[model samples]
Target: MKRARTIAWIKGLVAIVVTAVVFLVPFAFVLLQAAKTPDDASNLTFSWPTHWQFFQNLRDVLATNDGLIWRAFANSAILTVGSVTIMVILAAMVGYVLQRKASRLNPVINFFVLAGLIVPPAVVPTIWLLQGVGLFKTMFGMILVEATFGLSFCILLFRAFVGTIPRELDEAAVLDGAGPIRLFFRVILPLLRPVIVTVIVVQAVAVFNDFAGPLYFLPGDENATVQLTLYQFQGQNLSFYNLLFMDILLITIPPLVAYIFFNRQIVAGLTSGAVKG
Candidate 1:
């Protein structure tokens, strides 16, 4: 017993130290650089700022290019909300159907869903399709791209979680004269709260921090997401390290806060259906 306890204690200590080094160290470095003057930050050493310019750096980041960060925040907010909403509704509905019904197409549909996760997106084909549909470089188009890309993962999660739910509920709802939509929206969806929260937080962070998606499908300053604002402080020739770190700090906070608050839910949702009851 004593040997086991000592081993567990050592493992726990090592885990904590690893977590701090992996997460806290970089965050501290970014915080230090963000607080420094331009020249001090340019050095990029993980040391304290000689002269604190935290607020000044913040103001500069926000005020760069006539407050592009503010616009980027709005665009990212819209993109995240819109895409996650579509993903939740569509994924939940499809997952419920796939779980509750046994059909010839189930295997084929499952194959396609798995394929979506395996196949790397062809950027040129996606761009051509968007242009053909007249949705290229548009907010709605970007939302569609994000939603489509995230759909497969969300569907798998929802499907797994649905397995943990008893099918007797479906029977009861049907006997209660509920229609298909009512049965799902009123009964099934409410029970899916855990997975829904997981999908929302995970996908929202991905969409908000997606540099490539916005850079490719949604070009132009008018459609900039928060991640794109990093370009404002960085270029091929010149870079503003202070403002760059500040921008990273700002954009990182929302997702960090989300993870902090929903950490437990995320774990529970991901592990919910792992073992059959």
Candidate 2:
């Protein structure tokens, strides 16, 4: 018994050390690279920087082209929050309805959503449609597009999760003179806290990191998001490598902060259905 316990302890220590190193090594590289000069960054890729220029890089990047990064950052924040809000609320409501209804029409609607998950959007047709609708290149149009793309999966998660919630609660709410909307907003929705967190984190990350959607749908330089900020860092001849690094670093921070704060909540929300359902 003592020998087995000792072996188990040794194995646990090895696993912990390996896990730490796996996560730490890349971060160490990012920080080191962020501080280096273009010459050092390119020539000595993995070598330590003789001088750390974190603040210098940040200053130059922020001050570039009359503070354009600030605009990009603001745009990114607006897009992320607006798009994710639409995605999560719509997904939650649709998922809840599908879970409760479970009728023939429900199955058909679910099948159409599942089909969307499989079918790629036709880019040209979509662009034409948006132009026809007078929503092309507009912020709200992009927001709607992002929400539509995101909704199917969010709805799927909600449906799976809501299944675990008893129909008894719905019945009880009805008995208390609660209509569908009231029961949903007051009762069933509050119980969706865990899944809601999951949806928020997942959609927030997707929106913040989205390049393709914004690039194609909302291409104005003034309306550019973080991913588009890289364009400003580029030049015809010589590029500001340090400023580029700093731009990348600033763009990384929001998602990093979000992941750090909600990592546990997201995991709990997503996995809650495993046992509950």
Among all candidates shown, the one with the greatest lDDT: 1
Q: Give the runs in model 2 whose Cα sits over 4 Å from its true position.
A: 1-22
Clashing residue pairs in candidate 2 are: none
Q: List the residue pairs that clash in candidate 1.
A: none
Per-residue lDDT of model 2, residues 1-277, tens digit only: 9999999999999999997799767666767777877767655366788888888877888888788888888888888888889977888888888877757798689788898799987778878889999999988888888888888889888888898899899999999999988999999888989989989988888888888888898888788888888887668987766667668778888888989999999998888778654
TM-score of each: 0.98, 0.91
Expressed as tens digits, the lDDT of each residue in 1-277 for candidate 1 is 9999999999999999999999999999999999999899999998989999999999888899999999999999999999999999999999988888999999999999999899998899999999999999999999999999999999999999999999999999999999999999999999999999999999999988899999999999999999999988888989999999999999999999999999999998899978642
Q: For model 1, what is the error of residue 232's alpha carbon versus the real structure, in angstroms, after optimal superposition?
A: 0.8
lDDT of 2 at 44: 32
